[model samples]
Target chain A: MWYVKNALTRKNLMALTGLFLSFFLIIHLFGNLQLLLPEAEAKLQYNWYSDLLADNILIKIIAMVLYLCIILHTLDAIYLTVKSKKAKGSGYVKDRRGRASKWYSRNMMFLGSIVFLFLVIHFKDFWYQFKFGELPLDANGNKDLYTLVIKAFDQLWYVIVYIIAIIALGYHLLHGVFSAHRTLGLYHPLYSKIVKYLGMAYTIIMTIGYIIIPIFIYLNR
Target chain B: MKIHLKIWRQKDSQSKGEFKDYTLDDVHQELSFLEMLDTLNLKLVKKGEYPVEFDHDCREGICGQCGMMINGIAHGPLKNTTTCQLHMRSFKDGDTIYIEPFKAAAFPVVRDLKVNRSSLDHIITSGGYVSVDTGQAPEANSIPIAHEEAEAAFDAAACIGCGACVASCKNASAALFTSAKITQLELLPQGQTETSKRVISMVKQMEEEGFGHCTNTEACQVECPEDISVLNIARMNYEYNKAKILNK
Candidate 1:
């Protein structure tokens, strides 16, 4: 209860949930990478992997946790944003405060809203279809989620949206990853510097990795 | 040299405020920013008009009493310099300068270019000091503090409580100011007696003062006159979190 009311405690929750979500992105990317294989093999392998995750008890629990993290992260952000708006007394007549920080660092909520919108479309298309909608079976008797993925990305506009969303995600992580560490109290200068660079590297890799999947699929199709 | 000014003018806290333009002729390039304002005030008073009100003391950067948004940047465009220390040479003769008070919900405007910063003092009063027995002065080496630790503490202690961090922050957060005070005491042996209590109360008091949460934009350190590090914020988080876990 005290944690709920405290600012730092709320930030701690934000950091923990954010880091967990960041970790989940790595696993999600690797699993989805199977879509890059030769078409026939790709369909079977990707579908099989999807089926494997669906049937596993641990993956189901993790999925629930992932949903919870998303909700908490979003709600906390909304609360913090409202509090900040109230704290800012009035608008400046001739403001130029932007020079002090990066554009993306200051516009995190805007970037996050983009990513959040993409998540809705993403879940409705892939996640909902795989879980609740009817899908034809593949050669391996697995639900044909891979074909769904390929068909989705094959559309030029869909691929463009995917790339745009992934880019937004990259910018979000650029600030979020290291910011989470600082919120959790990683105070040493050497280690903090290391984390800062490591965050940049991770953000770059994740962005490239996610962006290439949609582009590669759209082009190769 | 001639200078153009668009300064905020308000009769008092209850009244609405707005920018009023004025021009000063024969302005010296070497005048401090405050002195330039003084000249404007002199002109206004000679005509039996109310001089524009602002805050300043010591005329040096050390007191931290003088601060304003010079062209929207707290403490002016110069890095690591205060309002009083900033000379008019930084600006061009024909340029227009906009001077505004430090604006925040916690810092209510008392008049033109002056806001009540007592909210900062409230945070300090909550737990910014140590409780020691009244007695003869202790020996210098009695505590045996490490040289590096003393220096680090001194770095945090260099904060003059100017409220530039609050003015510069997009969220109007006082994390840098509050954390600097917390870190200065938390680092030394003398401050050990109430480490857990000190962090919790100061942080609580900070939130109670209606300041926003720090999003770690690092602007506070950028605008801070002392170049106070954002790492102090991390340290404050470290202390606050540690106390929460241990105390509970």
Candidate 2:
């Protein structure tokens, strides 16, 4: 309640939700990495893993939380963007952006929108198909999510979309990960440095892992 | 050395502003940035033209009065240098320098390069002081403070309320400025008495002033004349979040 009304509190909300999503990226990347195993083995392993996640009560709870994090993060971004625009007043007659910070840092809202569009397409294609759309069962009787993924990746345009989305995700994470820590008040210089490096590592690894999955699948197919 | 300047000229807050170009061939590299502006103003005055108006006080960097965006930087190209402290020597002959006011919704242009920064004062009034009985001065060593803590508090106390942090921030956020006061007081035993109330009121006043949220891009710290740490912002958030959850 306090968060929705106050700008500072709302920012705290954005940071909290944004960090949660960042954490989710690591977990999601780990699970999806299973897609890189030997073809037949990967198909069985990924499907079993996917089904295990789908059937687990804990995963369901986490899924709900993830959905909430996404919604809150988007809404908070919109609120902060509107506030920032109004507070900016008239445009500067001479603009020199990125003199200090990165370009992505200033255009977080724009990057977030691209990532949001990707999420919508991503969820509709995989999550929706697995849950509601007709999906064949694998040898282990799990939803044939692996086949669906390969089919999606087989298309050059779909693979390109995933690559573009992942690139945007990389830029978003570049600023978001460390910014979230600062938002949560990580002030100590040494610890802040450690967190900064850790954040960069996470962003690099997650983006690479996600990018590799689709490309590997598309190529092998 | 001759210097070309593109300066923003605004008549008033309600009027539209424009950048007017002026070439000064008599500029000396030894003159400070503000002094160079003074020379240009004198020329305009001699010609019966309206002189450019700006704010300045101590000329020394400590006063925190004179600051304007020089080429889109909060206090010009030199890092951690205030406008009054910047010498024309930092520039080269025939370089086109752009001078403008620190732009923010809260910092409306008063005239030429001067902007109203009273919003910062209102935030301080909300909760920037310690209130105790004024009967007598406390004993010098009454409350012992750690040496590191004292030093840290002093560092936070160095903020000059110059609007550079807001001007440099991408979102025009005043988190750095507001946080400096919060960190300064929150570290002291005397400050702990009203820490909860002070942070709550100050942060609320900051938002009411129409400043944007802090995205922690850290451009403010890069452009801050005092070299104020962005960590101060984290400290402020810590105090505010603590007050919101625990104070209730």
Candidate 3:
């Protein structure tokens, strides 16, 4: 049965879901970067962009598909965590923590779960509010989602939580991106160094870029 | 240098085990770890106690029999080296070494440091063989496999089923050990006929034998003694996925 695969085989599921969601993260991060423009420019630009995405029949369907990817990614990660623990058994396996693995690599599930919780909070605050909550009118009398983002991020706790979430997200992405490359046959020995360095740089840039928006909003307020 | 040894002593599969310690004197720091154990056993026999029961053959380190946890780490702390090849110079003077057997569900301790590696043998026996019948040895360059494939296959074939992979694993998974044999056979032209069936049977047998799944920890690779890449594991997954998809 298909359920047997979902239930019994956790590792392949992890790799498949991990790789897919990694691609999803890249696209989502790229879209969110539109918010980085100056206030007047980004508000008009990003809000129109957001409205176009929400209004498009094709994009709405794709957004639903992206939601499915995130759900499957979470489920697969949970399944793999349970199975690996069962396999290793409930015994002291001498914190093989230091030498052979990165801290983020070993703690990926925990980091991922933090990111997952952040996503829920994020979707509630911004994604759902932008889509469904009543918004104050902009200068053009359009629903003002960009202003909403800037206003909400003005809270110190919101900015702190957002930064922590992005840091966790970055750590998760850092290990997953390189590890998935290795898993799915990225084996050119010379280019391997280039790929790893690129992965690290990608993680750092994405985290900092994402972090700066909330900080800028808070400080500007 | 003088050293104290606490070695696992179990008479047979039926007997319970305990840590039995004995001090060794006038030991050379240049001796290999196994050679030091050999010296301790020699002293025990002279004093009319049972020689410490451990496994070693081909003390040059090719055979996988010489492995025992030198302290807590499998095959000791050295990377990509077997117990027999690990020299005493790695240890400081007057070190108290606690040696124990490789522990796992499938690999039951038969006596001291030797377990029933027949589980690995069973896994290999399940599908580790090629179906080639009796024939003249093929001449060199007859098959003309790509040079990279041949070298990769050679690397996979280099696995000695030493169980360092299992011992080093958090889950004691045998994916590395099993995949090496699977990859070695799958790479050759002679193994092409049964390649589909071989991977399926070997993987099923591996799972059935109560071995756990690989997490790709690379701990096994670090402790492998042969430095078997985790790449072989990815190759195994790729092959298994292909076989299942094509045949299903």
Candidate 4:
């Protein structure tokens, strides 16, 4: 009774970070949707959208906040992971049997790492390109950010990599979303199942949405 | 299945213990882990040796009375299951196992694989309940406890106070057990009138009992035989925060 914290706080932390990331994904989805448009509509002219976002002081502040959230979530997850491992040490010689948790839940750390790697790739290509890349003028004489997107997505290997990352992201979110809600005090038994199923659906939709983008571009090209 | 056991054996409360070796033969693959120990005990009795003494009752796994360090795991290497429910088939032949009782400053080893869990009882007595009179039954449907709330409270109440949550924790914290009791009583109409006082007093008692802060590691749930949701802890936090801030 003197030392161990209960299993509940870990669940809450996971839930809060997960919900925050879900919100981020919505904004991210909207920003990426522009790439799905036809070449003309999505061309270097679209680069102005990026410039506008960059120029807005409020948006800048929000972005900073988003960055902080991401960092906090990652660190918290790491800490929980370590503590969970130590708690598990007490049971080192348990008769190897009955692991009741879903596989995705147990492997969340691995899946999350994959998603993190994907984010790095995504930032390098899109975020870095929009902000720092030297762009050639398009037919409309606007910065050719759209052309860059199309060209990157046109590569078969890049599309394949994106598809894999999106699949992993789906797995991570599938378990994470509902788990977070439970941690954040959504323990009502009546709606818990509903929440879990909806969380799964949400994970599927987001993963599929991201996965479809690269394939659509590659196939159309 | 065969297992190599490294068990800690102590004569009494004042005695320091050491590991004892055991070999169990023809272990039924389907027997619960506790049942396997039962088999070993039978053998020890037949051999005119002192049988291992451990705490157990309601072997259905809800009572939380049976717990030991099996193979270094709190309830053997199972997630969301009690020691009594852990089947021997989970292991293979020729396996070596280590068993010991729960160890903590507050939990003194009473015998071979039985530690005193009275600290938990004290925490409960300090304030795990409401002050409702024990005379007559109230109209059940009149109080209007939503179905969801009732079920949620029941789930938390499923905790048998086995102390597995504490034994499984790195810091030996009883937050899960404490939270479950707090949530169970705090959910009903009879309990609601005194929710603030109940939680404050219970948590204060919990701290006085020397339990550590919650760090969010989920090992207790993983090893809990009852699969009691760790979510009750969040509710505990919500209540504690509200009570502390509002000074209720």
Q: Estimate, for each residue in A1-221, the C-alpha lDDT of model 2 and write its tens digit.
A: 42476887888889899988998988998899999999999999999999999999999999999999999899988888989999988857666646988889888999999999999999999999989999989888888999998898999999999899999999999999998888887888999889999989988998888999888988886
lDDT assessment of candidate 1: 0.93
TM-scores vs. true structure, each candidate: 0.99, 0.97, 0.85, 0.72
The predicted structure with the larger TM-score, 1 or 3, is 1
| DockQ of candidate model 2 | 0.76
TM-score of candidate 4 relative to the true fold: 0.72
Q: What is the C-alpha lDDT profile of model 1 across A82-182, one tens digit per residue?
A: 88998988858877788898878898899999999999999999999999999999988999998899899989999999999999999999999999999
What would the per-residue lDDT of candidate 3 be over residues B24-74, giving only the tens digit for each residue? 877898999888888887878998987777778898878888787767677
Top candidate when judged by DockQ against the true structure: 1
Residue B57 of model 1 has an lDDT of 96
Model 3: residues with Cα > 4 Å off, grouped in runs: A5-10, A89-97, A131-134, A140-142, A185-198, B4-26, B41-52, B135-149
Interface RMSD of 1: 0.8
Number of the candidate with higher DockQ, 3 or 4: 3
Clashing pairs for predicted structure model 3, backbone only: none
Candidate 4 contains a number of clashing pairs equal to: 27
Ranking by DockQ: 1, 2, 3, 4
Best by TM-score: 1
| Residue runs of model 2 more than 4 Å from their true location after superposition | A1-3
TM-scores of chain B, in order: 0.98, 0.98, 0.94, 0.93
